[model samples]
Target: MDISMGDEPRRLTSCWLYWIAVPTGDQAGVMATLGLTQPTPVTFAEAETIIDEDGHGEAEGNPDGLSRVYVSPEVDGWTLVIGWWCDPCDGERDDEVLRRVTELSARYGRAQAYYYGAQGDGSAWLIAERGAVLRRYCATGEAEDDLFTLGEPLPLERARRNELGLSSSWGKAVGNDEGGSEWKSAAFHLAPKIAAALGISPLALTAETRVRGTGVLALTPQGAEAEPVT
Candidate 1:
């Protein structure tokens, strides 16, 4: 599935999800734990612009207003947090919320969901339910085809850049065969389950699989370097 040259880095379009449990702490502390020095919170106006362009947070979004979806560039990568800010609401509103949740889920369907919630004692919730971001993006020539011969602009979907938070933009490009990740992220996602099923390391299912807080491993049934898609 890797599409770019092994030596030259290719840029790609990536959207990620960060599952932040409600009322974790102020944004200041959250950024710190992620190793991000500080993050400038987007204003409602700025946030709206990004959502409007992406078809998220539309009037059709949800009744709660408790959910907000926005794109953010960071050192790690391009991200979108389909996050909730209210209590679970006695399950009375859970279904609607869950449905809304499903919408964002579909938008970034293949991303690794990193769950983060506050600890009861209140002193920085590093571990999510557990615990956990990139930058301005660089544009790679490779763009996916969508809708009536139209294509997504590569610049917006580029590599992690200084504006987004990464130290370098060169490695951020997608399409590089060696480091270019397949758009179908499910293989990386299902690695753990597949490994357990095959009784092998997670790497067997995929290469250099890094699922947020989850550590590294080999998952292929054949004891290969990384996991192979089933």
Candidate 2:
């Protein structure tokens, strides 16, 4: 079935079968923009996945705990990265989510795995080329029988995301009608390990760290630099 954003036209839900994309810049900001809460790392493994880019802090690795399988696919000159929180089919919903990512992962050439993060749910987000989205799904939003929700502008700008090698917008549905899965709540739910490793919760740890976790994609050549993916 097709989900409509009023008169904006219909979008396929097939994108759901794929994965969600979170920007590396503003994780919490994007969650709030979408009415979702920030997510904290759940298991010890999760804590390890979170990396600090600024190098202001560091975290110890978690040898125990559940970590989902990971896969990085390349499609249509883009990298499609996917990870599962757990396996669902084996009743390990989290691993299953990761399995889906591996299954959905594309081979080299077009779309490749760029970046991936573990999701609270049994799923993770994959970052791929904009072109991959077009080819992966029919231009008409038909071929894969998929639909997407073109929601409001994320906290981050498209120009910024370009610098991050991600798209400007993450325009699929990741929330309930009431925006149930707020990243803020997610952040609180997580162990300090995950949050610390990913450099998340900077808003709390630092005395005056800005909460600028906007998950926008960088589209310009400049965006593709070590700059924001606006």
| Candidate with best lDDT | 1
Q: Write the per-residue lDDT of candidate 1 for residues 113-151, one digit (tens) a residue.
A: 221121111000011111111111111122421111112
Compute the lDDT for candidate 1: 0.25
Q: What is the lDDT of every predicted structure here?
A: 0.25, 0.24
Candidate 1 versus truth, CA RMSD in Å, comes to 21.6
Model 2: how far residue 118 lies from native, Å:
16
Model 2 ranges with Cα > 4 A deviation: 1-18, 43-230
Worst 10 residues of 1 by lDDT: 120-129
Cα lDDT tens digits, model 2, 9-120, are 1111111122223323333332232222223322212211332211111222211112211111111111211222221222234233333333333321122111112233
